[model samples]
Target: MFGGPYPWSLYCGQWSILPPAPKGNYLKDKVVVITGATSGVGLEASKQFADASPEQLIFAVRSVEAGEKLLGQIRKAHPNLQDKVMYLDLTDLQNIKDFSEAIKVFGRVDILINNAGINPNFDEGPYKSTKDGYERVFQTNVLSPFLTTLLLLPLLRKSSDPKVIFTGSDVHHIAPSDLIETALQNGQSIISAYNDEGKYHNPTRYYESKLLLQILSRNLIKTLPDITTINVNPGLAMTNLGRDFNLSLSPSGIVGILWFVANARSASKAARNLTSAAA
Candidate 1:
């Protein structure tokens, strides 16, 4: 079910259509922090986690208003849930540090789900760089998350069973290794290669970024021996990650169609895997 014809076999199979998260207070007394919780799998994962009844569920989001709205909806459904939304702009390094510092009030975070990501349509124009001078995709998808995880290591270690979940992708396997090798051979860092506008490619940039994220997460485990750091592919789910793609005869639009087709699961259903990982 997991491996076969590209996305179709995975989409048609049972992996995409997951059962609802089992009802229980498995997360009782635990504190969970999730990024990108206002939409996509992160939004659904928040709801599912609420059902499991954690002591506190904090959502690290860029938009406090949107996070609050989602928190209200979840609270309305599960009145007993204790949740709050905090601002986290992945594009800015200082912002991520400030967000981590604010999280110190919670004392410890049992599970950290790095679920927020972006896949910009490179066809739109030249790649943009973050204020930190890194490519937007690389910053948002790889660097930011890595930095956040590092900053939160102290708080995470306080948990008896601390775990970090990185939302990875199957597409990572197809990342442009030629560029990566060429960059490394020239003494250019991966970040440098990504920032080079001359080498950026549509869609594949996202794929390559995911690959880098996966690699980083694996290495992170060595630094965090006690913490259960994992990277999980939520499979292809319809999410705002493809918000930039518009349907048309254009290359990006065609990729968007494939994205829609491959994403056989709803965000809610796909989130089961994430919540399950926390369990």
Candidate 2:
């Protein structure tokens, strides 16, 4: 049963009916780029795009090995589909720069999907900072994506209709005033703002970061008028993000996870929203 204001029937009634796979090569001859394409909704979106027969599909991933493995699977399924794997570690500013520069070699980029993100579990110790001295969640979910989108603008401009999709979450609806107040009170020091031991909660931090992304998406339209920038909230789906939490270890965790599994949409179904946005 739904626990929030909505009744179970109302929540269940809103479940997305999967849209039919796109017809007739909508992405034909266009280049599609996706970050974090090795797993979860990113991987599902990649599979969905592959079926559309794009001229080239590039994956910007942290692990070339994992990217290669996914590429192989896609190739096995669609032998003629052109694809490549590139390295991109969102936590590192230099990696984002290098990856963006590397992507420029392509004549044009029709679509850029910023789907990579991290939601550190509650059990994952105190808040961590990225190599760039920013909070890990903030850098991974917002800063890096912002930088990458800017760097890729020229390439995106080459296309007749360029689209940038930012993966967002419904959790962003949670008020961020406290987070803003904390950041201001801390003089915007990433460590000081997010490292409060008593206040640290991964899900809360993740929501704050996503809320920042949604704000960015709204402003992007004013700054980059030609490009289509949109933030998409893929409904909750079962994914490896929960690996760190052992549901079997606690009765409550078991029940909670089971309830989620029973109610949440599948990754593939959630991914349709992403692919549909891109198309």
Model 2: residues with Cα > 4 Å off, grouped in runs: 1-14, 122-124, 181-200, 246-248
The residue pairs found clashing in candidate 1 are none
Q: Candidate 2 residues 1-279, lDDT tens each?
A: 112333444345337576765656889988999998999999999999999999999999999999999999999999999999999999999988888888888888999999999876534456677787777888899889999999999999999999999998876776355856777786885435554555666646776788889888999988999999989888777777556543454676666667676777878878888988888
Runs in model 1 lying further than 4 Å from the true structure: 1-20, 122-124, 249-259
Clashes of 1: 0
| TM-score of every model versus the real structure | 0.90, 0.88
Per-residue alpha-carbon lDDT of model 1 for 1-279, expressed as tens digits?
A: 112235444445435446568678999999999999999999989988998889999999999999999988998888978888999999999999899899999999999999999987535456789898998989999999999999999999899999999998877776668777987899887777888888877657787888899999999988788999989878777778777754476675666576556555777777888887888
Prediction 1 TM-score vs. true: 0.90
Model 1, position 225: C-alpha lDDT score: 89
Every model's Cα RMSD, please?
3.2, 3.1
